[model samples]
Target: MGRLRHPGRYRDERRPERACRGRADRLLALLSGLAPYVDARFSLLCHSYGSVVCAHAAPLLAQTGVQVSDIVNLASPGLDVSTVGELGTSARVWVAQAASDRIGWVPNVRVFGVGHGRDPLDPAFGARAVDVDDAQGHDGYLVAGTSSVRRLTAIAVGTGDAHSVLAAR
Candidate 1:
């Protein structure tokens, strides 16, 4: 997991960006160490800042011959790259954003290297956007009985397509 220190409300904006870069570097190192031991294809399920870490580490992991089956980004703040293809993995990238999630309201632009980048759920980002009907907010996707949780579970286990999951309910 990315060790992003949650700063106080009054902290400088640059602190989070710095923290994210550091965490991404650490995550890349960790993935380099772990890739050799992963005998089978794997998947990544990331939330918030964790998605940013994954985005950075994925290219390096791909270089090590790690086959990533899927990458699920839930309520991501944004990713470091403008396009999901920059991740350099053949993984099926999935994204979810609750209708009521405040995080979704954040500007998707990166300014002065502060914000991460484009929203993953944006059609331009090239990710499969999943429907999160029951998720009420940024954190509600994890709550039991929420449609978001069920849909995510299905995607994680490779049982169904994200769009199909929404249609089934």
Candidate 2:
């Protein structure tokens, strides 16, 4: 229900499951408890490392029929997209990355000696990519009035499309 800044705390090695899972479990349990009081329309807005947490939690939430209305990921490091396909199809999934982002230019994913390539702008990724004209590295996402913020805000409100994400840029 609320925006989680650091989602990976639940599963990342740095924090480990014990430390973070309690909070996540408590949150999920609370959501489950409050599901009857609230409407079904809901979403999980994950940014950066938070996407990883959402990816891990999707299955458990599914079992509870909580229904993920949408997933908005911004300047993400791979959230294991292949695993996401298994996450129910009802939730509208979206992703946005700046064009001039140097950090995302390289594949941040590596597994079993194989690595996934960069495609923050690839249409096949099934998520719209918002473009940024600035050639800055990873943290260029917070430039106030830039296209990145505009498109990101639009997508977050469900008012933007692929073209709108890059409009007038």
lDDT accuracy of residue 8 in candidate 2: 40
Model 2: residue 134 alpha-carbon error in angstroms: 6.2
lDDT of 2 by residue, 54-161 (tens): 555655775554666677666666655544465445566766565555547657556652332334345555554455555255666657887666766676566767
Looking at candidate 2, the ten consecutive residues that score lowest on lDDT are 113-122
The numbered model that scores best in TM-score is 1
Model 1 misplaced regions, further than 4 Å: 1-15, 32-38, 63-66, 166-169
TM-score of each prediction: 0.79, 0.62
Which pairs of residues have clashing backbones in candidate 1?
none
lDDT of 1 at 120: 84
- As for candidate 2, its clashing pairs are none
Highest lDDT model number: 1
